[model samples]
Target: MDYTATLNSMGQGLCYALVSILFIFLAKKLDDWRTKNFDDDRHIDDGNLAVGLRRAGLYLGIAIGMIGALSGESAGFRTDMLYLLVDGVLITGCLFFSRFINDFVMMGNMNNDRECVKVFILGDGRTVTGNTALGTVEAGMYIATGFILNGSMSGSGGSFVQSLGSALLFFVLGQFVLLGFGLVYEMITPFNLRDEIKQNNPAAGIALAGILIALGIILKASLSGPFTGWVNDIVGFFVYTLFGMILLIGFNALVDRFLLPTTNIATEIKEDKNVAAMVLVQATIIAVALIIAHAI
Candidate 1:
């Protein structure tokens, strides 16, 4: 309706566009340096879909991390730009290095970086390319942590240093829950969780990735908004995650009963490697998580 206002918006959009390009480029160059014993760009050039997905996820993660800084309370165009650039660089540095922590912690004994880029030779004169399972899971880690960081970097209650402390604390807390959830999930599920993922079973990996992403969404809610004392907030986070975990497990149970009463989901996924079934599982998990997140 207002031509002058529209023109100003367009001008600002162009600035954001340029910054976005530069931010992503900077993240890629940082990845090149941070990734150890692995060459993501070379593998991507060699047509590895797994590597491509991981790299894509990293970019998307960077964007998500920037969203809070971009949209939060603005001090003016210049201040907003300052926050955007600062947050972009911070997100890149944190997430790039966090990849190593995730590879070691959440992945257990498996080396995800190596797994994604490793070549395989089969006994029947056939070669398996890359491990899509590890790739997808690693991507999930990036995207999920992005949401977590977004929450940490949000709100107007604390100083920047304090926010950093809260972010680090939340990140560590999220990791412990994730690790515990994996163990609990393994105990309840019929299939060998680690074995399936290690074997490059796409279905298993998808399920695991779905859980992590869903957990991230739910945790983001806990970390959002103003600080209400550290003890209360941390307790609230644990409570929210506890409820979310129950719902995640219960939803899977319901799916087993109502969705696939005759067929065992474990069998379909582990034995048959039914990606469709896993897709259903993944969708259900995220759908439940979304509901829980909004309700919280």
Candidate 2:
């Protein structure tokens, strides 16, 4: 073993750790500042899962988006830092915008910012507040964007500009794919998913969130690997995304038929608001996504 190389590796890891900590700290502060409606610290202390989950998503997103930049061959310290900076800004900005897109589009008319945390007035006129079920869906969007960025930014074959453009394009594509999937899911479900979420149904939210994040994972794989050419890369992205979607749909069917054949999956999630059923579905979907991500 070369002691010199080992020391170099250790130093690089330490540097990465420090940079990651700083990014997370700033992401937290930025998210809190934008929330505007409630004291994040206070709401978290009061057991607001909605606020907490939203916060966690950003945290997780920052971490996930950093994976590609942190890994791979270092192009000298200065170049690595430059790459990290550019990709970091893109990841952060896209995630911030992702919230609005998800809220306005897939959510179908629900306002996540307004619903995630709300203020209520009691008979005594004292105000109280808590996170709503919508927070989970927002959290999913954050994490999913992170994954898409990770894919777009991964690999070392492209020019920096090319890679950056790929990242942006894939980010947009990921959102559209997610929106498409949402429509398809809506078509299959017997109930109105957006309505259930509006009624504060956690199960409905969980199921939707699961599929979003799982698809994000798959897209990460789809976008990843060596960048061949613009045309090749774009074609490859769509092809992989289509394959991933098919696999995801197939697994959902499997879960419904074999994994939990006794119950109506829709009834459990939409009617009974069965968190456990949704959790199981989510777990199965994520498990399958992990396998596909690894294979890709």
Candidate 3:
């Protein structure tokens, strides 16, 4: 092993650690402002530390991936540092844009305390309200998008302006994919997602969450970076992404038809509020995502 090379790597790792902390702090401040204005619940207020950490963790993950992608073997500390700051800020913006789409376009945060029924009240009036795990699955959606975006931006090799354009285009493309998925989900269901969530329907929330995460998992492969300078490279990227998403949808439909012929997932979720059935759907979605991701 080369001692000098090892030392240099360690130094770069330290810089990454410091920058990650800064990114998380900045994201939290923005999240705080969002909570204050929009009535978005803070994970801390509900004592769900996992949710809080997951949000910050996604930011850190994106920053690290971006830095690694941009910092070539020959790049020095200063060049890498510059890449880190610029990419970090852009990725953070991506995070914010995702939040906007979820809240406004998807109506994710439509109602909190206003329409939510205490879980205990629905049952035997026990003291313990069951964990709805509300907001958790949606948060997973953000994290999955982060992973995809990070991969897409890697090895971009373009000028900063070109990279920025590419990143923005990819972001819009990602949102459209998500939107298309949500619309399909809504069409299949009797009840609207926002209304279901508002009424404290855990089944609806969990299944939707699974769908988003699974789509992200499969899409990550399509976003695998190192894009070339050729115009065909850009065209191929979009084509592959659409192909992956469509294939996943078809695969999911087959699973529903063949794996559980008698079961109606949407009705079970909307009418029965069957958490176990929802879990089964979630599991299938994840299983498919894992298989596809591995194949890719």
Please identify model 2 stretches exceeding 4 Å from their true place. 119-132
Tell me the lDDT of candidate 1: 0.78
lDDT of 2 by residue, 1-296 (tens): 99999998798778877776678888888878887666888878988778888888888988899886676677887688777877777888888888878889988878776776776554478754543557888888889889988888887787889888888888898889888987897778788888877767778889888988999999898887888988888899889888988898888988888877788679888768889888988899999999999987
Steric clash pairs (candidate 1): none
Give lDDT for model 2: 0.83
Per-residue lDDT value at 212 in model 3: 76
Best by lDDT: 2
Error of 2 at 80 (Å): 0.9
Sort by TM-score, top down from the best: 2, 1, 3
**Residue 102 error, candidate 2, Å:** 1.2
On residues 52-83, what C-alpha lDDT tens digit does candidate 1 reach at each position? 87788788777877775565565677866776
